[model samples]
Target: MILSTTPTLEGKPIQQYMGIVTAETIIGANVIKDIFAGLRDFFGGRSGTYERVLQEAKDYAMQELMEKARLAGANAVVGVDLDFETIGANGSMLMVIASGTAVRI
Candidate 1:
């Protein structure tokens, strides 16, 4: 299904609104990754481990969002929005949320 951050898709007119659909994913930080990230923070460099984890989480959330839209009888999702936040005690977990308007075009 097509996913767009804009309210409308170019050339394809929306035929029906299937209401809002959302997906959420929560990932816990690995201890080894946290240690490496801490070292990277102190040394001033990027943390590949954390980056990969975040990317994976985002991909999972987006996939779930697409599934939800499909279940809602939508061929596309418009006005897509993604949010990321740290959750859990001591911010040990990362939360990713994907939301959009399900539509048939």
Candidate 2:
């Protein structure tokens, strides 16, 4: 299935609007990883642990969004939007949400 951040896909006319689809993912820092990430922050380089977590969360959210779109019988997802938020105690957790309009082209 095709997914686009724009409202429409070029050269692909929308045949039907299948309503909206959305998915969210939340991940928290583990104890050991948190300690290492803290050290990386102090040392002034990118935190690989955090990056991995973000990537995993994003992938999971996207997967879920696609599944929802498929269940909606959509050929594509348009006007895709992504949101990121920090939650949990001391903002120790990460949340990612994906939303879009499921459509048939």
Candidate 3:
């Protein structure tokens, strides 16, 4: 399925508006990995652990959102929005949410 932040895909007309579709997930941080992340932060480099987790979360959420769109008979998702939130102790929990308007071309 096609997904974009813009309201419409280039060279494709939006034929039907199928409302909003969303998906979310909560992930917990690994204790040992968190300790290593602290060290990485001090050293001032990207944290692979966090990046990997978020990337996975984004992929999962997008897949789910796309499935929803598919169920709605949509060929694409427009105005897509992705969100991340940290919750629980030590900010171990990550919430990934994706939403968009399902549309048919």
Candidate 4:
């Protein structure tokens, strides 16, 4: 399905509004990854481990969003938005949420 951050897709007219769809994913940092991230923080460098984890979570959330849209009989999702937050004790968990309006084009 097509996914766009804009309200409407160019060239393709929206045929139906299938309501809003949302998906969420939460991931926790492993102890080893946290250790490496802490070392990187001390060395003033980017944490590749954390970056990979965040990217994976975001991808999973987006996939879920697309699945929900498809289940709603939508071929596209418009006005897509992604939100990220850190939760759990000591902010050890990362939460990614994908939301959009399911639409038929």
RMSD (Å) of each candidate, 1 decimal = 0.5, 0.7, 1.0, 0.5
Give lDDT tens digits, candidate 3, residues 2-104.
9999998999998889999999988788988798889999999999998998888888999999999999999999999999999898688899999999999
Clashes of 3: 0
Each candidate's clash count: 0, 0, 0, 0
Q: Is candidate 3 or candidate 4 better by TM-score?
A: 4
**Winner by lDDT:** 4
Candidate 3 vs 4: which has more lDDT? 4
How many Å off is the CA of 68 in candidate 1? Answer: 0.4
Q: How accurate is candidate 3 locally (lDDT)?
A: 0.92
Predicted structure 2: lDDT: 0.95
Off by over 4 Å in 2: none
Better of 2 and 4 by TM-score: 4
Model 3: pairs clashing at backbone N, Cα or C within 3 Å: none
lDDT of each: 0.97, 0.95, 0.92, 0.98
Better of 2 and 3 by TM-score: 2
| lDDT (Cα, tens digit) per residue for candidate 4, span 21-69 | 9999999998999999999999998999999999999999999999999
Q: Candidate 1: what lDDT? A: 0.97
The Cα error of candidate 1 at residue 6, in Å, is 0.4
lDDT of 2 by residue, 1-105 (tens): 999999999999999999999999999988998899999989899999899999999999999999999999998999999999999998889999999999999
